[model samples]
Target: MGSLLLLTRIGGRPAAFRAEDIGSIVELTEIAPVPRAPDFVAGLTGLRSRALTVIDSRKALALPGTPDPPDVRAPVVEVGGHAYALLVDRVDDVVAAEGEPTPPPATLGPAWARVACGMIETAAGPAVLIDVAALVAGPHRAAA
Candidate 1:
């Protein structure tokens, strides 16, 4: 059997995260902006009395920002002992992988290449398998 995946959309493109890497999915009602933080860092929000750093998946991929409604959907994850919420364009169903991940195409581009693990087939079709840790790290830190 292939890995289970949580499908999502980022920058208007299909993407997935290994299900084992995610803690939960949430709808953020409020985010307090973080000054002096990296551009990809959306800000901070609360979840279960715990603070979560919101990472804008678009900015993390070096894409331009879109006007977001007050509420945002995100997948929750923990990396290096810190919790983070990855803001995505949309959240889709959780599906089992149809096959193992294969190398991403050359045209995947630098921003994607930096965080993409590979491409995987799912019932929903093909999606770029994203590295949760890499996404939370942001483009600058992941590149370094």
Candidate 2:
């Protein structure tokens, strides 16, 4: 079944995902920093009775860094086995796409293709669809 993915910004680019992938959406909050982990590791937080690793999406995508928010990006995540938080610029509401799926750019636009399903036109311009599993553990996503 098709689902709605809450939209967010990665590297200032528009992005989305299926609702199933999301555990929960919390406003920018504090994180307990991780030691010796990747710079992108924004740290961890508890959600739905589990700890999810918050990460800097821009850093993970190798984009230029932005100022650290006193209240950081919403940590929309997937947990259980694969756990990682995407630090987006901000988040919008979940959009349900209608009609056929639009294809992403032929070339894997950013190095984030594994996660990107492609761009689809909504009432609001074109939204990039993302595969949560791919985003977290695709061949493209670098190792920790």
Candidate 3:
């Protein structure tokens, strides 16, 4: 079966997440820092009175640091019964996934390969589909 996908810019590269995996898309706001949190954890923000942990997409993808543009947004996604705000560069559009996703390319590198579920073709080109669970848990989780 196929599903809708939300295209987004993560670390200046195009990526996607299953639309069903997301709860809401919100504008970038003040995020309270969490002392001693992992580097990839962008910190925390609140939406509708609920606290949300924000994951820095660029850091998670091992990309060079770039300032968050004015339009940056966080897509609230739930995994393992907890919610996380994925701090992406921008939220593009929602599109219907054409077919089943194929395995991510080996050249995607370690950081991306760890969280990428697969790749799918979109009108804008191919986008690596992100695995929300792996992203939220992050790479260090396995070592801990």
Candidate that would win on TM-score: 1
Q: Model 2 misses residue 62 by how many Å?
A: 1.3
lDDT of each: 0.88, 0.66, 0.83
Considering every candidate listed, which one attains the maximal lDDT?
1
Better of 2 and 3 by TM-score: 3
Q: Number of clashing pairs, model 1?
A: 0
For every model in order, what is the number of clashing pairs? Answer: 0, 0, 0
Candidate 3 segments whose C-alpha is farther than 4 A from its true place: 67-70, 141-144
Residue-level lDDT tens digits of model 2 in 1-144: 245667777766777766778766675456788898767677887666767788766666667867445235474665457667676777767777654557788675566665667776555556778776555542344466
Tell me the deviation in Å of residue 21 in model 2: 1.5
Q: What C-alpha lDDT, on a 0 to 100 scale, does residue 56 get in candidate 1?
A: 89
RMSD of 1: 2.4
TM-score per candidate, in order? 0.92, 0.76, 0.90
- Superposed on all Cα atoms, the candidates' RMSDs to the truth, in angstroms, are 2.4, 3.5, 2.1
| TM-score of candidate 2 versus the correct structure, residues matched by position | 0.76
Which residue pairs clash within candidate 3?
Answer: none
Model 2 regions lying over 4 Å from their true place: 67-75, 79-83, 107-110, 138-144
Ten-residue region with minimum lDDT total, candidate 2: 133-142
